[model samples]
Target: MARAVAWRLAAGLIFGISTAASAAAESFDCVIDPAIVVKVGSQVPGLLDSVIINRGDRVTAGEAIATLSSKVESATVALMTVQAGSTSEIEAQRARLDLAQNKLARVEELVKRNISAKSDLDAAIAEAEVVKRELALAEMRKRAAELELNRAQAVLEQKTIRSPITGVVIQRSLSKGEYLDQDKQLATIAQLDPLFVESFLPVSKFGSIKVGMPAMVKPNEPIAGTYEGTVKVVDSVFDAASSTFGVRVELSNAGQKLPAGHRCRVSFDGTTD
Candidate 1:
């Protein structure tokens, strides 16, 4: 597989010194290559609650692929949410503050009319200030509770694994109810759309192909589609043995109608850079 991928890469970067081939409507052997393949894994470890994806499944970016046991985390999140949602603590503090303010107001009027002493007004003012400070403290606690709830929710999200790319699931390494260790791989995914059509041309034609030039790709037996592709690479280095330059073509594979690894032939028109 690695050699095949390297050969495909060479198709785009072929460099040669010979009076090679023409850039006309000529054909060269090629192979379909996947643009990207990834082995998806998890960041944390836990018992696998479920594996929702299997081989041959089509997944979108950010789709939930699997999940770990999150019962405890869910319960914690719920508890934190309730605590964060509760406003009784702040409400009680606010009530006390209001009462203090009313007492201060009454004491001030009474003192002004000589019905109360200055010490009573002073005491009432102190009580109001204390209640105001208590209210501020209560508000801070509420904010702290809310922040904790957010943290719990974030942890819960991590317990559920999501796909990082939109692609096809080619292989799955895990099953539901299995113990998934930390950083364990769960599945392999591959992006096939806009598949790479890599091919090599004679060294002499090295200077003829230009990026963005249109070409035709003909897949071998079993794959009967003739796909249109664009020149994406033209290498300037020569392979010691083949003495040929490499050229790469990119073609659209919408709906994955064409499969990778199939042998193909690519044709380019008599257009040079």
Candidate 2:
């Protein structure tokens, strides 16, 4: 009887331990977020000629937003071309070549008749050759001028600024006719449509999360309903600073209702629970 009682007590203890462990292993909820703010700036510099879009305006990729006044730059390009076409040096060389050719023809005729000495004919031929070289050099100078004109035209084109990515204009720093430098931050753009909702995954959940997994986001603010997204990226390396790996979920906000930098909860279906 004593042995049986002892065995029963041990079995009850094991059952209680198993039940506690199962309760501890139950799934729970986690709030998702890796919020980031984006900025915008121009790659080149000039006077701000136009500001087409205002703050809070949504923009598409490769859309033109602002531009620098290119009138003066365009005129400079035209002037350089004119200078190349009508330079005095080129005209002078052409005239010299024409005179040398005429003189050489006359000398050759006299030499055939033996009226002009051979040495004189040779000297005239040498003068013609020198003139020909000068004409070639003049042509080379024109080619260089043409190259300069092309470069000037390219710079003039760069004055017009365009949006780098599809996003919304968050801020505008300059107005029309404002001077800007190459490194200046002209505006700020945040991708709202299909914006990325960054979140953290604990080390324990690393094996469960994978690319293409479905996710649901609930913004803290008044969004219409739960936003759907997919796991776009999973960090290969752990973030030592946070003791969590990073995961990115892409959600669309075509209506511009989901504002960037909003805190949100991300729920993974079936996989997490």
Candidate 3:
């Protein structure tokens, strides 16, 4: 009986040691999280003319993702452009001012030769001044028209929605033929590269984990093997209820060779503060 009891006791000790070793070897559970998520939308209200992209489509920043029915806006821009380029009114006013100046010169010569009355010269001077003022007003109107054209062009550009980031289209909210406004959504986008791995570690191990530390990230599937990860964030505050601090690691996914939002495990081989 004594020998049998000894064997069982040894087995229990080995099991306990193995369990402790496994737990220590594995740090914590991790989730692959996207560092960039964007919701594309039009800045101006209009009829949804067309959606240039579909779900699962890859897009680059500044690329046109969707457009609005902007015929009115386009017409307004063209009209303003023409009006801004037009100087007919200012030219007409300038011609009148030149004529008034010529008349004033003739009147002064006539008065000096005693061929015209002093009142005639005064009348000519007042007429020239009035024409000059009118010419100034016309030039001011031309400048105001040019400013309106600039505003029109800006409004036209706002009718189209552009991708703010290089990412995949996860959803299309506003489709073609629908009316879009500030309250409407256009699409959902998520950047896949440089993915982030989020996890929480016990505060006791906080002394051992540090930002900028190298670690290994193993994804579940469709992305086998280990990818290099760099520790990016270690929360300063601890969760009192769980006694854990959050940690974040970044994984470079250039060319988007791997998928995002997958379950992964991070192993900090020799992480130490």
Whichever of 1 and 2 has more lDDT, that candidate is 1
Each candidate structure's TM-score, on Cα atoms with residue i matched to residue i, is 0.82, 0.65, 0.81
Question: Candidate 1: TM-score?
Answer: 0.82
Model 1 misses residue 18 by how many Å? 23
Residue pairs with backbone overlap in model 3 = none
Minimal lDDT window, size 10, model 3 = 264-273
| Residue lDDT tens for model 1, 153-268 | 99999999999887899999999888888767899998888788888878877777899998888888877757788998888798879888888899888888888878888888
Please report the TM-score between candidate 2 and the true structure.
Answer: 0.65
| Top TM-score hit | 1
Misplaced by over 4 Å in model 3 are: 1-27, 109-115, 269-273
Q: Residue by residue across 1-273, what tens digits does model 2's lDDT show?
A: 999999999999999998876644443333433233356666687788888989988787788888888888889898988967767887899899899999999999999999999999999989999998988898888888888888987888688777877877878888888888867778887766767887777777787878998887776646546767888898989988877887888876667666677666676662221
How far is 97's C-alpha from truth in model 1 (Å)? 1.4
The number of the candidate with the highest lDDT is 3
Off by over 4 Å in 1: 1-23, 233-246, 270-273
Task: Answer with 2 or 3, whichever has the higher lDDT.
Answer: 3
What overall lDDT goes with each candidate model? 0.86, 0.77, 0.87
Residues 164-262, model 3: lDDT tens digits: 999888888878899988876889999988899998888988878888998778887677788888999999999999999999999898888778778
RMSD of each: 11.1, 7.0, 5.7
